[model samples]
Target: MKKIVFLFAFGLAALFAQAQSPAKIGFADVEYIFSQMPEAKQIETELQTLQTQLKKQYDGKVAEFQKKLQEYQAYGNTVPDAVRQNTERELQQLQQNIQKLEQDSQENLQRKQVQLMEPVYTKVGKAIEEVAKANAFTMILTNQVSGLDVVLYADDQSDISDLVLKKMGITPQAATTNPPKK
Candidate 1:
């Protein structure tokens, strides 16, 4: 058991070392771009409204299902077997319908996300390329799950997020242009 544990630990260490030992490496987080972009809040609001609309449109079926389920539960001990079976069947069908609606909503959300954010994402890609070229970066990466990226204490002045955002033609929130009303 000790040998097996030692071997496992050694293997994991070797794998981690290999992963960390890139010859030329850089790091940037796309999350930062999205969070900082002025367009992101507008897109998020649109996404929320779309979800709300879908829920409203499909609410009747959901409400009916809930009502039937309540009735079935209330009469569970008193109802005839055939009535119980029929209610169960209807409940199953309602669940399947709910599943289909959920799937459709998810697909629509994905499609809308692509449509709405592709342009912004494209700009971010271009900006990253510009940063890499300007800074002579060989490989830019990211470890931006929540906190600061692992960079062995590089200079904060060396961080190029501001430069990348500038290159993308994105103005600061204070300088953002207002959209014209229809």
Candidate 2:
């Protein structure tokens, strides 16, 4: 009958649709993985040392500038016009040097951080890829809790962060309870 045929067709369509749906989606927190890495602590220590050294140098420059500024303020009015103008030029140059040094230090710190973290990031990325391929994950989303939320909602079972860590030969901590489901 026409009704039977139509019902059969509809059932076949539904089954096909279900077959075509994505198999799995996973979430990972790369920052969390980095926090667990031993090398990360070492990198932090190195960066801190560099920062401290830079700060000391910066402080010395600042002290020098302050000393010069004080001298100018105290003796500026008593000095000859040409001497005052030359001191002003020197002060301006010192200020410019201080600003340049601060900028360079910041840039150097950033560069060093990237250089140190690059290998760790690559290792984590490869582990994530391996886990995704082995588990047949259709997509693996980063779940970093920066200012913006990367993932709105994911089932606890769909988190692949532990698996990636395990792939990297790191034992994961006990799983935490999932957030309340909506």
**Which number leads on TM-score?**
2
Alpha carbon lDDT of each predicted model: 0.75, 0.85
Supply candidate 1's per-residue lDDT for 111. Answer: 98
Quote the lDDT for 79 in model 2: 91
TM-score of 1: 0.63
TM-score of each: 0.63, 0.82
- How would you encode candidate 1's per-residue C-alpha lDDT over 1-182 as one tens digit per residue? 99999999999999999878755555665766666787899999999999898887579778988998999999967978999999999999998998898889889988998999999888888888888888877777653445544554444444566577777776534323221112
Give me the displacement of residue 157 in model 2, in angstroms. 1.1
